[model samples]
Target: MTPETGKTSIPIPERTRPPRAARRGAIAIRFRPGPAAIAAAALVCLLIGLLYLALQIRTIFSDQLKQEYAGLVLEAVERAESARNQVGIWQQLPDATEARAAGYRHARTELAHRLASLAALVNASPSAAPRLSPASFTADADLRDTDAVLGTVSAWWRAQRDADSADVRLRIAHVARTLIASAALLFCMLITALGMYAKRNRLLAGQSHEFEWAALHDAMTGLPNRRKLFATLEAAATKLSARSASCKIAVLYIDLDGFKQVNDSLGHRVGDEFLIAVSKRFRESVRKVDVVARIGGDEFAVLVREFSTNAELGEIARRLIACVVQTDLTMGVGMVSASIGIASFPDSVDDYHRLVAAADEAMYRVKRNGKNSYAFADRAN
Candidate 1:
């Protein structure tokens, strides 16, 4: 209450909040990943995996070629050693015959050819160049110490080959592990992006649905508005046109009597509450298929989809009148009553589009005669 104005203040009720579980459920629904997101993530992972696998296979192939070349070089070294030993044995013969001399020359020539081949192989290999070079084998002439040099070169080549093979295997293993970890990390990132995309889409869809509902329904009473009622009437007329002649549709335009007086005597808040209460009663008084809509302030329209006789519509009108006249104590301020005018397809109005106007005209006739009663459009006409 305000001390200066001496008027009591009514406190507005606080808005009720949703439960924690309900909020969590709403979040889960809004962010749940859709099939399109999952499929896109899977496609990205598959493409990356294929690219990585191709690179790994190429590395393995190159390493295999390296191993094959190393083996060939080792074989060349062995051949050179054998040729050198043959040349030495020929030189150590007791008789100095022409055949022995010719044989020694042939063996030395073969040893020189073998040594050139080993040098070419070793020079071609980039990794072997630091430890073994072409000059290392060719610098020693007369081939007296060739056997000892050959033995050392053979041991070095074998050790280098084993080391290279081990290194290649270790590198491939490390790359495989790294690739696996990178792919897993990429997959996780894609999934998170997919979830975010789905959540945004869900939020947009929810907002769109809310906008559509708000457009069609009355904001205060949550009932169908004038536009929705007209649309329903058009649909009902089209549907009944295809059926038998007995199937008919009707419209009842209702105007509240003495509502303005109540609204003026009491406040607008009471008027709004009274409207909501009566609207609920009007809705409850009709069948599930029937539509009760708030067309204007202190005015409503009811769509009866199918009715066999005028009496059936009259009964519905009486029910609506009762919904208003038998108001609860909370809303019964002043002498509030309902004056309803009924109009049916192929009877009061030739066209379905004119049904509401015809009913409205009849409702005004009721107001002129007395308030709180129902009348047919044909009778009013």
Candidate 2:
């Protein structure tokens, strides 16, 4: 200890950091959006709603303003007309200082005030601003509105000293008023035109549906044609594919046995009537769910969605033959019967044409045996 200055040096303390656990805890705190952020989002939504509400209010207000403005324009026009009449009377008078002249002066003042108010109203909205434009006021066939009338009045007020121009302006103002009246009806006409267009479209849609129906059906018998029958069969085949092996659909291909004889002996008119009667009988004999189609000529087809047994099919076929043969017609030809050929799904394969051919072959077999009988397609021949 060399105590030369007699003052000892002060020792500096070392800095200490926070504990590791405290540091980790501070860092691991997950920041989530708090109540303030939620409130801000809600406020934004409120603001949007308010803005839309304001826009709606503005639209309503603008419409009301337009109606009121139109009324005011009409009133101003009436006043101008009155003023014009007064001016005419005043000019006819020997004394220019007559009560009529004083009345015209008052009318002019009132017209000016009305015009100023109209201008202010037009200037209130940007869209309405067009109402106050020079083009809207011009004395032309193209320019006829509230603005044009107001413009004519303004021009007349300024040009009253010029007698000729004032007279012309008054006439133009009358024309403008007429145009405004007609213009209001223009809206109604447009609405009516739109309604007519919509009605025409609806009619066209109905016609289109009818046309499509006609294309798919026989005009005479009102039964599904070959195209419709094929489509229905294809759909049935798809459905049958999903069913159990035991489940089956039956196709009864029928031909009116004596239809040709009637068609040849009787007129086509009688034949058609007879065919129509046969179609009705066939429709009555089959179940409502069954599809009956007139493929062509006297050839017809019936698709039974689900037929359980061969006996059930035979019963339907017998009914068809009996119904047709029993019906007494105007024609001298006594009676006609149907030869039905039954072909079931899975047994005859799902192919529509092949099924029809098999049924047709079976029908020929029946025709060979007897005209009035029905037969099942034989797998062998």
Model 1 bad stretches (over 4 Å) = 1-65, 88-97, 128-144, 174-195, 379-381
List of clashing residue pairs for candidate 1: none
> Model 2, range 195-244, lDDT digits (tens) per residue?
65677788999999999999999999999998898888888878878888
- The global C-alpha lDDT for each of the candidates, from Candidate 1 onward, is 0.84, 0.69
Candidate 1 local lDDT, 99-162, one digit each (tens): 9988988887788779888877877786644344444444336465566557776887788778
TM-score of each: 0.77, 0.51
Worst 10 residues of 1 by lDDT: 130-139
The reply for model 2, stretches above 4 Å from the true place, is 1-187, 243-245, 328-332
TM-score of candidate 2 versus the correct structure, residues matched by position = 0.51
Q: Pick the candidate with the highest TM-score.
A: 1
